[model samples]
Target: MTTFLTFTILGLVLGAVYAIAASGLVLTYNTSGIFNFAHGAQAMLGTFLYWQLTYGWGLPMWLSLIIVVGVVGPAMGAALHALIMKGLRDTADVTKIVVTVAILLGMLFLSQWIWHPEDARIMEMFFGAGAKVEFSGVVIRYHEIICLLAAAAIAVGLRVLFTRSRVGVVMRGAVDDPDLLRRCGHNPDRIAMLSWALGSTLAVLAGVLITPVGGGALEANALTLLVIDAFAAAMFGRLRSIPRTFAGAMVLGLAATYVAAYFPTDWTWAGNLRVSLPMIILFVVLIVLPQDRLRGAAIRTRERYRAPTVRKAVTSGAALVAGVFLLALLMDDTSITTFGLGMTFAIIALSLTVLTGYAGELNLAPLSFGAVATIVAFHFGITGTGLAARLTPWGVLLAVLVTAVVGGLVALPALRLRGLYLALATMAFGVFLSNMVLRDTTEHTLFGVTFSLFPNGTLIVPPLQVGPLDLRDGRTLLMTATVLFALIAIGLVALRNSGYGRRLAAMKDSPAASAMLGQNLVKLKFGVFMLSAAIAGLGGVLMASAGGSVAGDNFHIMASLSLVMLTVVGGIGYVSGALFGGLMSGVGFTIIIGTFNDLAAATPPMETIFKSLGHLAMVATALIGMGVGKNPSGMVHDLFESYRALRNARPVLIGGAAAQAVLYVLALTGVIGNWWFAVLTACLVMMLPVFGRMLAPTAVRETPLELVGVDEPYTPELRDRLDRELGLAPALGGDRHAVA
Candidate 1:
């Protein structure tokens, strides 16, 4: 009974912080329709600032709290809402999620960059260490009591503010109908800004309260991810209810405490389960929650791109192969290995193009699929007395098959859900795979073999054997990855042009419209999931074979989401986008950082200015990728359009090609090293599209005299109408509809 009481007191303290974080999340989402994936990140940033102010600057606790929560937090929220999230309510849900996730990652990078720590820092208690209360053999800190009361007070206070306050009604109206709120003479932007301020403030308060709960030392990502627990609580309130969210937080806290206190400490499974308890709760709640509450009104989906012709695709493929061959000739073994990694990542990104871009379903966990493949290959490809390794081809096939089955099972449950709900479900699956399967080699007899599937740490991957050929060589791996990438690219293109692709496109455009046309969305969705899993699995097998081993950490929960972000930045609608994403994210990022670092190291002053890209490249990519929301068609698409536009100036293309040829000759003659020549050639190649555009004839949108007299379509009458309706009217009549 005394143990129970002690655990109960501890649980309440934890629950109070959760309640505060969740309430803040709910508040912003309610008013903005943006389920901020970065909510926890904002809280994390606040935590760091609070710590920095108190410890680093030697400021009083009160001053630190006031500045961190008041000035820093609100300013951060206001900047996000005003700069990133304003006018995004009607945008595609993918864009919204991506933007928030970008911010989440950006803040993580920002916090680390600023603090720049080699180790964790301590968080001071709200009150003096000795301040506490004791009753019935149970002891609780004054800070604990304070946190509990604050949670309750906020819950009750928010309830009153929402129900009885005029400002609350306006805030509610803004998200539901910003136009309506504007009609009633309330500034919707102001309401959004105010909600963000309040929301960010609450997030900071939660961060401050929870700091001591982490038991002193702080890790930024760890602190940020702890809000995964709060996600369950927020979902309990359907993302909008204050009281229910509070209640849910308390329940989770109590349950977690009880599990830790009573579970067998000797069992590794029990300990792992304790770690995964919040994920379990989140998964269960997301699965069991009423679907309608999560699904909101239709968001304006981005327009799909026109399919590139086979001739163009073939031309591009040939160019790609030729480029890779030349690149292989020029690069060192290290470059070859890095390039192979890029190709492998590209293969995985192709899966995203198909699933999220082509199918219009947001999958937040693509890496889990790859992880599945890695595990399967490791198990099947090991040689032993009882069981010899399967043939390389057969092992790879088996790995893909296993991943497909897992993906199919996951897809079956997500048929009724879409957008954010589906994303959450996939994220849950990722978390489950990471927590329960990864690093969990033990078996429970009563529960069966699924629980015993994985190993404790690194899984040894056998060498890739094809008859007499050994593919463990670096060059061999690069060629193998290139071949596999080409095959997947060809397959993706074929699929995009198939009947399934047509149906998928229709369903993506409008599920209701597709159903009316007699399309079976269930089958379409299911088949695509399997296909995507297969491609992702193949990538994983290639990656593992190259590395010679696999570990659980390689497939973290955030894997799939990060892929989406990178691919989207490159472009998601085309196979080229996947390639761009792969190269840019993997090799391009590595190469750029390497070049800069080399230059930096060569000069003493510049060395300090350019840190190893290894530390900042991925983070920089994510930060820049936030702009992808504004470029819905993606950078690849724009590049292709520019390519087509530049085709009229064949001379420019020829000139750039001639320049590259000269550089290649120079490299061969040893006038310049192949590495430097390759770099120069790459730069020249990148400039072709831009130079083509510059040399190409300026596009004249002016109608021919014969068509100028026509009404509607591209005519003045309809153009003026569209301009007026879109609030693009000129200040003066003479300025309206003037031809550019």
Candidate 2:
């Protein structure tokens, strides 16, 4: 009983912080109708900023806290709202989601640039130096108590404010019907800004309070993991009630602590269960939540494509292939190898384009499928213990097929899930695959002997000496793998553009309408899922074959996330976008980093500028997508269209050279980076035009207000009601026009 009591107390302490985080998330979502994916990063930023002010700048802790939580935190939220959310208010949920993701990425890179946590020694200076506390035979800490008290105070305060205050009533009204509130004369944008500020402030408080307990080795990426539990809490509350959200957080905390304590290390399943508890909570909430509450009500417009002329398509394709070939021939062996890897990523991105771009499903676990494929290939190609090695090609074939089938089966749950829920589920699965499955070090034994699946081997193929050039045997094998996969991926793309693709598109645009029109949404979704998985599996096979070894690090959750980011940033739906994203990201590991290193050495200022610009670029890209009310592809497609038109026009007198002027400005501002990075960045920016087109609403003359239920024009009475509902004072005559 004493032990249980001690554990329970500890859990409560930790639970308090999680509760605060969840409340902030719920508050923001309720007001803005957006699940701020960057919330964790924002919290991390606050934590880091607090450290900078208090320790680095020699400010008092209290003063630092005030500045960070009171001023900077709220300012960041307001700026984010004004710059990104405001523009995205009328856009699709997916675009808003990607925008948040972009913000998260940008913040991550920015934090890394400003202070590389890997090299920082602030964790000990700020958090770990604290002393411990003891109560009733249980050891606790001062920081934990502080965290608990702060969280409790915030939760209680919020509860009272919402239930007992007039402002709360107005906020609730705005949440329920922003349009109706707008009619009453409140500026919804102002309300949203306030909510964002309040929520972000709370998030900062939670981060600062929790950091002392956990120690402050916080980075934007690392801290984001804590938000997973917060998300589970919000889901448990159905993202509605504040009290419920707190309760949910408490439950998760207690469950995690107790499970971790009781579970024996001897049992492998125990470890898996312990790590998987939050995801289990998430999955359960997602599965049990009412469909109406879960399904986002965003209408997506169908893409209108103008077919490229055959001559143009042929010329473009030939030129691209020839350039790649020429680069391969002229470049060093390392560059050639890097290019091959880029091609492999391109295959993976192509798979994403098919699922996310064409089908409009946010399948974020393609890397998991790749990991599975890698394992299967390793087992077949090298392991000599079982039937796997004896039947190498057959085993490989079976692995790809089985992975595809499993991928489709996994996606079955997503057919009923949408938006954030779907994204969370996929992310959870990816985490599970990375942490539990791939990271498990246990060896499989046959006949009392443990087998190593990644045993070294070499394949030698006699190369034909063509003219004066003799390609190495390994290069030939890699090239063969690349060409085979490329062909297969291209074939799949063609298939996607056919009747089957149209069916998937129709289902994505309107499942109900598609079902009414005799389309089998279930079958279509399943087929696409399987196809995507197979393509991913094939890419994995190529990746492993290229490296000649299979390692768990190759398919980390971060890798999966990077794949998703690249796919979105490149262009979700277009084939060209996928190809572009693959090349850019894949080449980054080699060419981009190498170029940055060179530039950093040449100019000391270039290092800081490059890092800052990279971070800012990510944020700006995401914001641009949201601001334009489209995905990355929309921007890319538009640029290409513009460029094509420019190329076709007769040469005119260069009066101002507007395009050249813009390039010169970009170069002068130092945002362009190295020549290669600049070119890649430009290509990525260009592809954004076609990115979110399929997910955006149709092009209409009127705005969202006119298209929605609002019929009357804006009036003073309407404005007053809006103000009242959004927690603002009504105009003098507006209060008199209340319906009651």
Candidate 3:
């Protein structure tokens, strides 16, 4: 009983901190209509800042706390709001979500560059060498108590502010309708800024308070991930209510703490459960909650867009393939071989494009599925006893099919959910698979024999020799894999241009309308998810073949996030975009790291700057891609169009191709040895789609919202009329549209 009480007390203290963290999330979501994925990072930054001021700068702890918890936190929030969130206010929820992700990435990289927590700066600053406090029979620590007290104080303050303050009223009003608040001569932007500031301050406070208890070895990126639990709390609060958010946080914290205390001894599975408890809770809440109550009404008007012309899409695709082949041939060196890996990633990104861009679903677990498939394939390939080894090519085919089925099964719950809930469920699935399933290290024995699977066997089709070339060599194999997958991916893209693809577009534009038009939402969604998963599985199989092994490290949650980031950066809407994204993310990383290593060897001083600049550029590119609406389909499609236009002008095409050849040669040679050359190459590649003058004009034209009949002035009456016509339901307390 005493142990239980002690555990319970600890749970409560942790719960208080979670409650505080969640309240900030709720505040931001309510005010800005954004689920800021970067909230955790903001909290981590605060913790780091507090540590720096107090320990590094030799400031008084109290003063350090005030500056960190008061000034820096709010200022950071304000800057984030003004610079990123404000501009993205009118963007899609998914876009807004990605923007926060970008911020998180940027902040994480920045923190790594500045602090390098591995060097012990963070620990020295926050933990203070030796500090502890004992209280009651439980022997409570001072830091835990401080965290609890801070959380409680913040909760009470928020309650009073929301209930009594004019600013709070304005914030609430903005949460409901920024346009309405603007019409009333109030600046919603100011309210948003204030909310961001307050929310960030609260987040930072939570970070500072929790750091001592949690540990000071927190990297900004890893630490920020704690916000996932906070998200669970906010979700439980319906993302709109403060009290509920606090309650949700307390529940998560207590659950986590109690679980930790019990410490499951059953196969180390308990650790997984403890870490995933919040995600599980989030998934459950999302699955059970009413979508209408949880999410606001559709913020932006949907556009009715036409598919790209078959001729144009095909021609552009052909050209892209030819270009890649030529590049592969010309750069037949290690870099080119590395570029093949990029092609594989491009395939994965294309899979994401299908799910997110075409189907309008934010599926975060695709990479998890990829990892699973890869591991499974690697196991089969190495063991040589399973159905896979016995059947050879048939086994590989079966593996792909099974992976698709698993993906579909996982996606079953998603049919009934949408928006943030769906996102949470998928993300949880990824974490669960990684932490619980994949992370399991128990060696399995089949038929009374323990089998080791990885880095010891040849699993791919044996090499083939043709004329003067060995097509089965590693380099050739990679090229073959790239070509095969590229073709398969492009074939899937062609499928998207068919009837099924049209149906998906319909579903994305309007679920009700699609249903009215006799589309099966459940079946369609499931099919697309399965198809996307299958493609990802194929990519994974290829990845395993390339790596010649499968370790759990390859499929970390961060890798999953990287895949998403790559897709967003590459453009999420087109097949070509996925290819571009994969190349940039995978091969691009290798290229940059390799280039940096070489440059660092020469100058050493520029190494730090190069590393920092490289990451910064990646984050900036992703943000710019998302912010500027240069999404996969948007950019790739435009580029193809421009390229086609230029194709008609042979002189321009010749001139541009010749210039690109020269630049590529110069960069590849030692003539341009600086990192700037690589950076310029990346930028030029990325910007090709943006500037159409150098490329061929595409026959497929993207229809802006205005051209899609969504620009008709938005008024209450117009909104009502559209709602009635589309059979769309209003959010919260509003008149339900009567069926015609």
lDDT string, candidate 2, 412-490, tens digits: 8767876677777777777767656765665557799885433332221122223343323345544654565456545
- Model 3 Cα displacement at 520 (Å)? 1.6
Q: Report clashes for each candidate as comma-separated counts.
A: 1, 33, 17
Cα displacement (Å) at residue 406, model 2? 2.4
Best by TM-score: 1
Candidate 2 displacement at residue 343 in angstroms: 1.2
lDDT of each: 0.78, 0.67, 0.69
lDDT by residue for model 3 over 593-635, one digit each (tens)?
6766676677887987777666666556546543533242345
Off by over 4 Å in 2: 120-133, 172-176, 268-273, 293-319, 383-395, 444-489, 548-553, 602-632, 643-740
Winner on TM-score (1 vs 2): 1
Ranking by lDDT: 1, 3, 2
Error of 1 at 457 (Å): 1.8
* lDDT: worst 10-residue window of model 3: 455-464
TM-score of 1: 0.89
